[model samples]
Target: MRGGPPQAEQPDDGEGQAVLGTGPSSLYAHIVNKDDIDGLLIGRLCAQIVLPEPDPDAWQDQIRDVCAQLRDQYLKYPGVFRAALAMMPTNLDTLRVNEGLLAILLSGGIAPRTAAWAIDTLSLYVGAYALERSLLVQRQRREGDDWVLSRDDLVGRFEALPSDRFPQIRQHAGELTAGSGHDRFDFALGLIIGNLAHA
Candidate 1:
């Protein structure tokens, strides 16, 4: 939970403070505790990801573990999501995460397509971290939350509640769960891919 060399703990203050411009030495004066995940595990996991031959079958599994690791790291006080941000200060452009790294990840039995997803889509920048957080948040909610109502169904459920003690909760509950995953992803992907046709 402690004892590592301190990392510069700053958020996305890319305003006057550009990572390409200023050193992290004087961004601000705050420090985040390094209750981050084991660097070794993260390295190994990254090694396991980015494989050229990632198996689609095992992709979900690898995704699960990676998301779990992210969640575990998130369990720390403050925010563990910033872990990836902290790791980005090095020579990221020349970072050589070759297929060999991907191959090693596939050796762990990850699916080829999933491995490619990890390598191509997920590993490009902090994009993979977003995917990881998405999975982690969904799993955390799925495990602990019992809310079966989507937004469309929430209005009815809220009105069905016993008392007005939950006024604020009752007020904005429907806006929470609006669309299905399939609809959301399809619509977004459609816009992206469809826009390409126009461009």
Candidate 2:
């Protein structure tokens, strides 16, 4: 994906070039418009997602699972997450996903406004994570064998921070950098879900 200012309008023809050996004009023969492409791709993304049946008892766990699944789904499609940032769900698959999330929240006795806000918040979190990951992927592709920074280098810098000025950061230097992407994602997801449950 091409990275630029947020307002940039970039055309993505990489898929067409890879598959058809041509530009998007050839791709357009199949997809009526850009919205059609978004729907088709997102539909495939949501196809296998199994939303838990409505159960107030299991709502928290079920919603957690569903949110995790949605985040993973967004990351699965290499560059499609960016579309999610701009477009609302119009297709059946995405609508079903939205319906399932709202149902779980409402069943748990969450206020209607809270449930509505949570959907938007959760979606934004997932999209932001996906965009960050995609940007890193692009950077790796561009850098190839050239290394950006080693783990040792990162740790060393963190450790060398002035303890007096950056006391908290210095104290938790290792903790700051420790954890895989999945670990951090799960941690944040749990916090969001837990806060929602309590709220």
Candidate 3:
């Protein structure tokens, strides 16, 4: 998972050979094809996530911990989440993680349907966040060619927009570009999980 160009850029067979330290024939002997590899890789990643026991009183914190664990795992490999985007969670380990999250949500008093949807939403957000972060890291690593703008740069751009058309953006540019690290991630998770009691 750690070696290679981002997952988006690496060829499946090539990755398999490199990872397995074998030729294509040997790789095929163990797995059916690229899709199988994708499933297995994602399954392994899901298996690494630490799930908390269901606790009604601490459901919010439990949910946050689960999501943070997922985010940390995705961030480690820098683009491995792309596999998660392309496939459904058919792997046992992936389903285990989902079940664990659903249990926590349901314990919090969320309706069954709402809890299911919340899991979907949280998974989507985590995957997208990880993919975006991976791309940003890659761009920043390019020699003398960083594409991700600094918070100040983004704020300046927002403030430079036509004043009449973007009055709010100009006025609140600093706030708009305020967060560092995973602050925005935590705030977004709070918005999603904090409302579960009333959901």
Candidate 4:
């Protein structure tokens, strides 16, 4: 009964009943199935996001702000983004967020097709990032130690590789693994959004 991601293939009716303190009949009365529950949860999460008014002069910053907000919200629920992956943006709140992001991109003079694809790309990245973070936390908790490779350990491993066989990895191990907090996240988003200027 781990509360990580929702199991799309097999809905846990027992867990749902336990959480609601009701039997299957009682629980199913309000919700049709697990997919319905997932949709509702995702919708509620999306509803919490505060989309900023589009500013043509600062569309990039606005996009970053919205993405950061989404990352924060996704991290709050630890793996809830799995449900988002299982479905399209049929929920009103989810659609609202999508529309807001599209508006921001369009306000910056991005092409309509580019703006649409950007929204998909951003959403995918944010969800995948949060999902990975959640899984790492869960693994750490289960193992009773940090589950990720330490920077020093990673660097050492890279450095130990034969120079002829792995010249680049041995020479630039530190740079390869460099980043703390959300630095990589910011860098990746910057690459994506920065390219939109030409689009």
Candidate 5:
């Protein structure tokens, strides 16, 4: 699947947005199983599978029927347990290396368990992604202010962090939050897609 630049975005992707109008990253949120194909496609590459390629009308009808049923459940009982696959976050570095990797994995006929395991391994990205988004939102809000990040500002006044108990935190303070937002994400994604080899 590793080929070229990432393709088109899903038109309806903006719907799965968080309550705070925050965007969900490429991270999967457990709604990709049999009953929720449409849900999986929200921010993930699964959306580009092109289900309607054959009989566009039929494809649209089927997709709509599925989405409608899902939407109905939400209206009838908000926050109900809807079925989904809940894939683990896979190595994204490979994806950035080759956008087509997503399509390959989707069609590869790999065991679902293995797929899930791989996804789980990439789960580390979720936290970094969330933090980056929060930072961006705050930065946008305080855009005009001359925000100088000094060491004092960096090390927020701690009230007994128990460094003796958690030595790693005390030792690698900067490494914990070293890179720029983009750099951090890129680094995490590098691990995600890092193991790809041309077939």
Candidate 6:
């Protein structure tokens, strides 16, 4: 689950295979290609995300719980989202998660088309968030700096913007970055769920 482009480690054949503790031939024999490996990893991660039983009264809340669990799993496997982002998860584990989400939306009276599309949007939204966060943490570690200080500096820069040119940025800099990742995630999740219900 290396971040960014999936490149061969040393520009040599079987380097990645070695990393997986297998010979080049054996690795290729089992896994068809990099995409296969991505599927396997995605399946494993999907397994960790538990989906609650469908509940008409609490469907929205149950969906939110699943999202939070997924976020936690992705964080635990830093960079996994980047690697598996493009993979189509047809595996049972991944499908089960999708099924659970769809069931919840259906139970909440969301239209079929909207619920289907919402699955993709919600999945991508959470995956992208996890990927960005993991990459930022990795970069901070490599640079040996405090993320808190960096975030503060960024906020300060925003506040220092010329009020005449960037009034909104200058005025709401604190509110712009006030919440934790979970808070922001929850806000967006609630919005999506609310829209589904209203639609």
lDDT of 1 by residue, 122-192 (tens): 33333343545455556657855655444566777775666668776676666644565334533443443
> How accurate locally is residue 125 in candidate 6, as Cα lDDT from 0 to 100?
88
Q: Of 4 and 5, which scores higher on lDDT?
A: 4
Where does candidate 5 have its weakest 10-residue lDDT segment? Answer: 76-85
State how far residue 18 of model 2 sits from its true place (Å). 8.8
Candidate 5 lDDT, 11-39, residue by residue in tens: 23243333114343442243333223233
* Candidate 4 lDDT for residue 70: 90
Give the clash total for candidate 5: 14
Models sorted by TM-score, best on top: 3, 4, 6, 2, 5, 1
Report the lDDT of model 5 for residue 161: 57
Task: Report the lDDT of model 1 for residue 92.
Answer: 27
Tell me each candidate's TM-score: 0.29, 0.79, 0.85, 0.84, 0.34, 0.83
Please list the residue runs of candidate 5 whose C-alpha ends up more than 4 Å from where it truly belongs after superposition: 1-163, 195-199
User: On a 0 to 100 scale, what is the lDDT of residue 134 in model 5?
Assistant: 47
- Predict model 2's lDDT versus the native: 0.73
lDDT of 5: 0.37
Comparing 1 with 6 on lDDT, the higher-scoring candidate is: 6
The candidate with the higher lDDT, 3 or 5, is 3
Off by over 4 Å in 2: 1-27, 30-32, 144-150
Error of 5 at 137 (Å): 3.2
Ranking 1 against 5 by lDDT, winner: 1
Instruction: State the TM-score for model 2.
Output: 0.79
